[model samples]
Target chain A: MDLRQIWILYRHEVRSALRDRSIVVMSIVIPLVMYPLLLWGTFAAMNFVEGQAERLTSRIAVQDAPPAHRDWIDSLSGMGGVSVSEWMDDEASARESVARGRMDAFVRFESPPAEGAGLEQNFQLRVLYSAARDRSERARSQVEEALVLYRGAWIEGAREDLGISDPEWSGFAVVQEDLATPEEATRFLLALMVPMLTLIMVALASFYPAIDATAGERERATWETLMTVSASRGSIAAAKYLHVATFGAMGGLLNVGALVLSLRWILAPVAGPEGVGGGGLPLSTIPIIAVGTVLLGLFVAAGMLVFAIFARNFKEGQAAITPFYMVTILPAIFLQSPDIELTNRLALVPVINLVLLLRSAIGGSLALGPGLLTLASMAVTVVLAVTFAQWVMRREDVLLGSAGAGLWEFLRSHFLRRKGKA
Target chain B: MNREPVRTQALTKVFYDESRGQVRAADEVTLSCSEGEILGLLGANGAGKTTTLRMLSTVLRPSSGKAWIMGHEVRDAPEEVRANLGFYSASTALYPKITPRETLRFFATVNRYPADRVAGRVDHLIERFGLGDYADTRVEKLSSGMKQKVSIARTVAHDPPVLIFDEPTVALDVLNAIELREIIADLRGEGKAILFSTHIMSEAEKLCDRIAVIHGGRILATGTLDELRETTGLHYLEDIFVRFAGARNAGSAERENAG
Candidate 1:
């Protein structure tokens, strides 16, 4: 592309973008205002959740037990997180307690066994749980485990000839994941939000202004004068791309700034305040995450401008940028998945790579090679997109607002006609 | 051949609509205009006059034809062709925020004016176009006449060899239109080849050295007023135009009636 013409288009795009109030709000103001509020809200929510989880105590009702099952029921009442209450033969009364949410669960025992028969001949216990209870599901599972332990011991005593060692193996085996610092958890959450915000800001700042300056001008027929000059079209496109990219980059940077300033506040409950030993999250990684966020933001903005130029007018330009919004939001949704991580190959997946990289950086274990590769991949992708955009600029139909014409018509007529044989 | 400033052969621009098939905006049109002359292009609305001017100016490439502007092929050497021409039309929009001076300077830079001469070029055009008074005013706030003048200034700032104008005075008042005519005359006097499209027969009669009457993307006839008068046996240029264009439309009407 000719640098001079591109510069002219770029300058106009940037100037127009700066003048738009909506673009400015979406790109800069919204992030600046929203980040702090969101951070404060998130921290508040996390604190509330932690408190609720810790204070929870489940109340369960037990009924209809034979004398042989009495000891087992008593053992369950002894468990720390569960409060067991006895109920008479009326199952309806116990169920009412569960419905009222006064009791998390209720248990009932069957008929008594004959003398000289085993406890298996006696009775089974039934546990009824309240759906409203948050930890009622876990409490119910623990109750079942207690019953199984009793049954296993009875079966082992009955089968003395069979060689069985570990009867408690199936009851409760804890599987522990590597413990992450509170900072890591906070970074995980921010990774989802930061990339999406950056993408959105870039798109808003660049798309409309780029369209207004280029396609909009052309549709108004003013571009004829620009094109009639000695300037090459390539140069004009280059200038325009540069101008748009700068605006988009600025928006991304502003969002990054907002996030950096609000990071500690937003993640305080999860990561805690600096110098307080409860949270392992470091507030210092904010700058590192900001760099990656800003780079990704620029790429998004430039790409949006290139795509927005395909629109026939300002209104159509807005419609055309819908996919870009989806592109940004889609990756943020992926970060909510517990399995997603910052792997080497994932760094090449466009916007997701930025989020993943930022997550790893904030979490304090980013691999340098993957981070650099992600940057390189983004640069290469940007280059390819820009090249395609240059070709679109060269196309008379695209420049003239005829880019939306049916593909078959373009192929059978314009493209085929250019090939001479058609 | 005279040094033709603009020439086209079989120039056709077909606009395809999904709902409606191919609409021939400009169809199989062969034309040429020599240097240092004023060629008036006359056509009704949707008759492809603007499209023709666009192709000649290298703004819109022809769908399946060839054109040369100042000896440079528009398709192959668009930049060279663009470098050699100035173009203006009423449809041309102005940048809303920037002043006329800034817009012109920006265009001048893109047009590759020598750094030493860029300032002088902008100044000359600003003074010559009478935009000196409002050169620093944002174009969005400028009067229509003033904006028109700025558009003209922008077009002429680089002083190319050819100029194409398409109904540039469409929205202008009588006084502004006359001033624009005067400006066109002045530019022509400097020996720059000029092509202008207009529906106004009087303007074409007064300003054009030669006239090409076009209808339905096809030129029906072209000549000096005297030549057309001799051929059509009509006193006024409008009479000749009406006789030929009216006959073509009437014949099509008759065929449709018969069918």
Candidate 2:
């Protein structure tokens, strides 16, 4: 309970952690540089693939179009990346050619154009393209667009010939109006990614330091040195908890910050200019997200420290704590579907609640009941994890690696034991 | 009477090994070291030397009985005991990244040393231990000899009245071992009661004011070297140790047969 002793021990860990190259690199440098590199590499690869797909020509065979539509049919050949060839074989053979990649598409009008009742040709057009082939699908779409344009032009000519006004044919038009604010537009984009990112980055950040604090001390033969100091085991645990949690929170924030800062550039191609039209989150939700981040840091850092205490060395510590990384991530992954909302029951689930809470906050409609439950849920988990870690730290055999018990035995002894027993 | 700086009464520790059930690592060890005294626990490996010292330092909890550091019971007041004691063993190592000066200052602050005296105490230890040349260097960057000196300085950083050294020279070279003995002797000269453990007979004979012979988790005999020599009629401390260890093992076998 001595603040002075805890502070001294905390400073001890901080000094060691700052100089420990692995901790610095994992928690600071990687988070700072990783997002930008990932965004750049992704966009570059996407552009290359799209450019390659665009430059390939679409070859289509046109068949049985009357002289009235011949001009428009021939225009397909004039369009860029489109080649039109007349079909001389049976329709079956032409369809086969499209499927086998000999032709990208087969454009066939019904065998005969029906004479319309009043100066209009009534014919059904069938465009055959292989869905499995990208070129075939593109060719069909190109031909379809050209045919529509040709029909519109013909209608214009026919109207002129009949002396008809434009209002006679055009009757209705549909216009779309979006009333979303800039904050809402950017907020929806956060719900899907931020939850998983926060958990994963915090978990990763907590890894090396927790191991260094517990198993690293044992390996370096300094655990006994620390044990003999005047600080209580609980104080030592608290100091270590503060140290690891700081790194975890810093890492998650840095990565999220870098990504949010570059949100416009990263989303421009996919979401268009309006993707990040205004760069601001709702002021009310910032505190919620901040609390969530802090809670996540505490829970994950305490859990990592608990698991790491079971190990006698760094390698064993990593093996011991690796399962925690997956368990931390699996809940986020389970809540991947945004429709997974925080019902009263789901609100108490650990990582899922955080995901839902953050998602609801980003979407600008976080209900008070769910938000409080989420905070309480995470707070309880943090307390339990930290308490268990502190308890383990006080055990002579666990701290000294003298006991033969592993993870299962530790848990069994803790959870399954009778009242008032060790 | 002089105050006992380190005292234990019937202290014991039992560990359950998978192959060997219910092993008593330290059994009914009753011993005490007074002010300005050097007491040695001499035994072979796994003869309860480290275990007894570990109990006194509050590293290992005693399964039965009690140990006190400067009259503070280790079980009830662990931090209190640690505040009055300094422990240095092979396992009590210096932080690789911390300089010796920082190590001393940090330990002093943690052990509740006076805030104003910390800087002076740290400087004194630095010069006293001849760590001036490498005092600012990280422990990992220092030579083994230099690191050894820093470790020794770190042990008494808080200027505790009671010190326990559990086989600290087990890994040191012969020359370094001799140097460490001299350092320990100097600490005793400053009136610190030290409980030193070793398996080496010469280390006990030359350095310890009183030596306790331990075997099979129990202390077979405890007295000054001259008193032990007289009682056992043995010239060398090594033969006396063998005789004591053999007697304990033979007594155990005979008791088992009778049972």
Best by lDDT: 2
Lowest lDDT 10-residue stretch of candidate 2 chain B: B1-10
Tally clashes: model 1: 15
Which ten-residue region of model 1 chain B has the weakest summed lDDT?
B106-115
After aligning candidate 2 to the native by TM-score, how far in Å is the CA of B10 from where it should be? 1.2
Worst ten-residue run, lDDT, model 2 chain A? A111-120
Q: How many steric clashes between backbone atoms does each model show?
A: 15, 0
lDDT of 2 by residue, B63-144 (tens): 9999888889999999999999999998898899989999999999999999999999999999999989888888899988
lDDT tens digits, residue span A1-422, model 1: 56546656667656766666776676557757677777678768888988886688777777766676677877787766677776764778777877777677787775545663464466756778765766766668868888888877777776664554566434677778957655455556555556566666666656555666565766565665556667677776777667666666677667667666665445444555642233333557666655665576456656665566666666766666667767765766657564677777887888777777766675566788997888788778777777866776777776666766323344456566568644
Off by over 4 Å in 1: A32-192, A218-225, A262-291, A302-307, A368-373, A405-422, B1-3, B14-24, B63-65, B247-259
Question: Can you tell me which runs of candidate 2 are displaced by over 4 Å?
Answer: A46-175, A264-273, A403-405, A413-422
Query: On residues A96-205, what C-alpha lDDT tens digit does candidate 2 reach at each position?
Result: 89889999988887743445534556466788899998788888889888888888888798788988877776668667887976667667767777768877888888
Q: TM-scores across all candidates?
A: 0.71, 0.86
How good is model 1 by TM-score?
0.71
